[model samples]
Target: MGDAHVDSEVRFEVQGRLGVIVLDRPRVINALSHEMVNRIHAQLVAWADDDAIERVALTGAGERGLCAGGDVVVLYEDATSGDGSETASFLADEYRLDAYIARYPKPYVSLMDGIVLGGGVGLSAHAAHRLVTERSRVGMPETQIGFVTDVGGTWLLGRAPGELGVHAGLTGTLLGPGEAIALGFADVLVPSQRLPELLERLETEDVASVLGALAEAAPDAPLLDERPWIDAVYDADDIAVILERLDELDSDAARDAATALRGRSPSALAVTLRAIRIARGFERLEDALAQEYRVCRRLHAAPDFAEGVRAQVVDKDKTPRWHPATVAELDPAWLDGVFEVGDDELRFDIGPGTSGIITGEHDDGDEGARE
Candidate 1:
């Protein structure tokens, strides 16, 4: 184990047979910076080859949760800067990291305790053991900021049962622990207070045995009851038809969901829906991530991305004036542009031993935590 400061910058330690990763940015709820991602990637690559490390455990430094997501302020800067080199590098490396996690061979346990957000989801959701606490708040609220979900959001969210994934994407909804489990985002629930004891046990006990001893029963998910309506309304591929369907529902849940959808950037809604739909057919995490890269590249230059960031992050006004403010006004060609990967398209350098991935990041300061 290292000193407190050393641990804060993403400390990697071999505690007995366990490989421990502590995300140490408590001040910003353990947001993923570029440097932190690099450190994590380097260590993870090393650990994959080390026979002494029997299992891996990831957790945040503070009580706030695992991670907020990638650095959005940096993303905002990159988006508006005209030069997209930084943004491109971040997305490519981040996506590769996500793919590596999906394909990692060992026992990977993620303690998704608090606010596991967008970038945070990339870190935890693909683990062999994804644990959530009652205090956990998870989602991809990128739509509100005029960005579609990235970090393999389409792959994960698209695979959700029924139309729950589409609803989650369109509304930028944050799911609590129960909802998360119901949505298949988490594999187990362990009370936050018991996490330290679980970590202590991981030093000697296997991940499954420790979880079986400490995990609690998850509460019922209220969203499950609304699935009928969620499915009916969100099934439409066209955003306008989807909204129209929502408007027709007699249930208050439908009305509320409609209102939430209306408040988001129209372009983001359309693009997110398309991305999720496309992801439904993807055979690999890397494929979905590559598509997300194409979309993120196009979105960077789009007016709405910068404006959405300004309203939500910079001004804190929460009032973005989306061009093509309504779904009906959105040009199909513009939406199609997101799928066209340029010469600089992302490609994962995956391998048997090396898994070929790097670190991913999202901003902790943003309103939405990653799902």
Candidate 2:
């Protein structure tokens, strides 16, 4: 309704009754920084009470994507060069923002146009209306950096049909628009060419009416057809058992999945499996976020996280010599402390409203964006 306020990396504009947020750091694929998280949360809090704003929409600048994820290089530096308190604080704020998005009172629309992964998924997937295009490539690829999926990812992935969550979580598989919608990460399939029109119409028209006019049928999701083999191979909680089953299965997808899992940090894979399983029982997205926070704190202190980040991000080397080397070598007892509630447990204090907004102070540290 007034002049646009561009906060360096994140830009906000009120167009008529619609509030638009544009993640503006195209160089980093609009990766979320600590400052960006705080700014977004504060804006959401303000708009939750603004009568003029009937709906909110989130998108990204450039053609790359909405967000690549949280800036992991900063996280790498925090883990390797400093005490991990900064990383912990950043995650706490990030998670709080994600939880807020899940329960936002107004209609929250996300344009999942391009490479949405990790923190990107957290931002968009939890929205009330998640729109994906043919170019959309989404997933939670945290295991690649020896980190378990957070931002309420386990809650969404755990509820995915028949071990598909387990397969995707363990392999860090990227899903196309079709697979994303089929897996419940997205809703309508709108062409990239029509996104601008859709946005303009959303400013004045009802969300469902605008979508019904613009949405198209998504392409066939091949992953949905592979459920039999995927469910058979990934049905077990034990990574070793899953791997053995994969080797015994005849499907090439299963073999590829096993190979992918083998290359990941064994501890991360184990803990990810545990987190997803435990998340299946949780009723709230905040519960999964809290659990992930505990696991994340433990991961920040572990050696594999640093090594994984170094190999993947710092050194550009694909090889990471994990602590245990393989799933069989990982001691089952070692994962116990990772899920335990600690003194720094994440809390979502309900604010004085029906909007379910979290009221608290957040760390405003600006970490650079990560993919």
Candidate 3:
């Protein structure tokens, strides 16, 4: 590989003519920092204006991640003093970047190699071309962290194959390459070793061409494909029914999923599932994002999110006390505020509505990595 490079708090480089961005902090599994967010935004905008740049590739700096998600330690710390005010600010800007990448102009590629979860899911999932490797391990996982899946996941999850979105949101389970692709969370899957060679080729090849080439060499199936589950259950509109089918998996995979779901906040799961359903058939991305913002504001204003994070991450208690513990106890009115935006609440200014800024970026070039 040519190894053309740029380094800062994170990293921005070029492989031949391709713009390559690496999430540089490896210590906490490449947890995203605010500075990295600002830099990535700046670099991407700069790249957008450069005529010489044909494509861009985004990756992580360490062995374990394309990115694990946002800095949980930071989130936990921010909420420690009974001030969830900071949490709102972090999410607002983070979602803005997620929207930015989703709408970026050039070929934006995400090499989802390993540990792609939560906010990590946001950074990559919306890209036009997502490449997963044999080592790829992806998930939404925000339910476990006391947050609903932010970073535009509510919209994506709302639309995943069949009932898969509800399944993922409720359980916070991990999805391997095949499962990710099957769920429509990823587009292509290449082997781990061929990555560097592929990046070199990306400088000259368009996305369609690299996919054509990679397809000839790669296998047909994902590592842990979820076609069976998706076909049988993912399409079900009802969340409770999905659980019944999952209980019938009769395999280790199903058992693992069931166990993970048992530990999550049921109220969060229920609200999340409904939010996804309402978000469906949405004509624009902002419509969906605004809906998510409503849910988040309620999360902080209420007791679940902050307290959930407290017990699970901050206090390390592993025993979150979820009020209205059952789905049946939840009220539809809880989300009305989210849908009906207020003066202090967050709202996106997507095209045809406000700034007409780009919100859905498609990766036209096989820029870096594909799922």
Which one is best on TM-score? Answer: 2
Q: Mind giving the per-residue lDDT tens digits that candidate 2 earns over 335-365?
A: 9978878777787754433223334432222
Off by over 4 Å in 2: 351-371
- Kindly indicate the candidate among 2 and 3 with the higher lDDT: 2
Q: How close is every model to the real structure, measured as TM-score?
A: 0.93, 0.94, 0.82
RMSD of each: 5.4, 4.9, 4.8
TM-score (C-alpha, index-matched) for candidate 3: 0.82
Which 10-residue window of candidate 1 scores lowest in summed lDDT?
A: 362-371
Writing each residue's lDDT as its tens digit, candidate 3 over 193-269 gives 87777787888888778876774233344423655775576456555566677788877767777667656666566
Pairs that collide in candidate 1 are 69-362, 70-361, 70-362, 70-363, 71-362, 71-363, 117-369, 117-370, 118-370
After TM-score superposition, what is the CA distance of residue 221 in candidate 3 from its true location, in Å? 6.9
- The alpha-carbon lDDT assigned to residue 85 of candidate 3 equals 69
How much is the lDDT of residue 81 in candidate 2?
Answer: 87
Q: For model 3, what is the alpha-carbon lDDT of residue 149?
A: 68
Q: Write the per-residue lDDT of candidate 1 for residues 205-278, one digit (tens) a residue.
A: 88879998999899778888889888887889998999899888888888988899898888889889999999
Worst 10 residues of 2 by lDDT: 362-371
Best by lDDT: 2
